[model samples]
Target: MDMRRTGAIEAVSDGGTVESIATKMGNSIDQNKTLQKTYMLVNLASVHAADESRKIGRKNIASQQNEIKS
Candidate 1:
């Protein structure tokens, strides 16, 4: 929150209008929310990918035992 307020102060110091600064802050918040959602989705995808890889690499002990009986 302080970081955002400080950014607004900097924006105003750089001659931005109050309305534009407020809009920029709102846009930043929305962008952060979107980025957070994307971050979570990426983490979820990675976890699922890892699970699938593990499944693919797993050996079937029953199949191996049956083959040995042949």
Candidate 2:
């Protein structure tokens, strides 16, 4: 269902109390912020993993060059 319609349904379910609606809205916002922070952490982890992989690859390449010289 559309969000607006679902929200209206929720409001109705809560007996249309302003405080109840505002509290629900606040909870939703908090959940969204939590989700956003989680997404950022995952993105940062991916970047760090990629950087570590590059470092490993560079080390391998340098080792191979030393082996060739020897």
Candidate 3:
């Protein structure tokens, strides 16, 4: 084969490799963003649950105090 043909083949191969690497990197970045969002949602849910628990405890304490007064 001629040198020009060999060079063309090499160029095409390199382009494919670069494109594949870029695609993989993009996918990895997307995955990281998704994971971060999921973690944030989980944290928010935990905080909400804690708030609800505190509210219930306060209500129970108020009930007990009223009972003692009665």
Off by over 4 Å in 2: 1-42
Q: Tens digits of per-residue lDDT for model 1 on 1-70?
A: 6676556556545666555754766654334655334322334457679988777666566568779999
Error of 2 at 19 (Å): 27
Query: Cα deviation of 47 in candidate 2 (Å)?
Result: 0.4
Q: Taking the tens digit of each residue's C-alpha lDDT, what string does model 3 give over 1-70?
A: 2443333334434553433432533434224555324322334457679989999999999999999999
Error of 3 at 28 (Å): 25
Residues 1-70, candidate 2: write the lDDT tens digits: 2564356445545456444544655544334555334322334457679989999999999999999999
Where model 3 places Cα greater than 4 Å from the true spot, the runs are: 1-42
Q: What is the Cα-based TM-score of model 1?
A: 0.34
Would you list the clashing residue pairs of candidate 2?
none
- Which regions of candidate 1 deviate over 4 angstroms? 27-70
Q: Regarding lDDT, does 2 or 3 come out ahead?
A: 2
lDDT of each: 0.56, 0.55, 0.50
RMSD of 2: 14.2
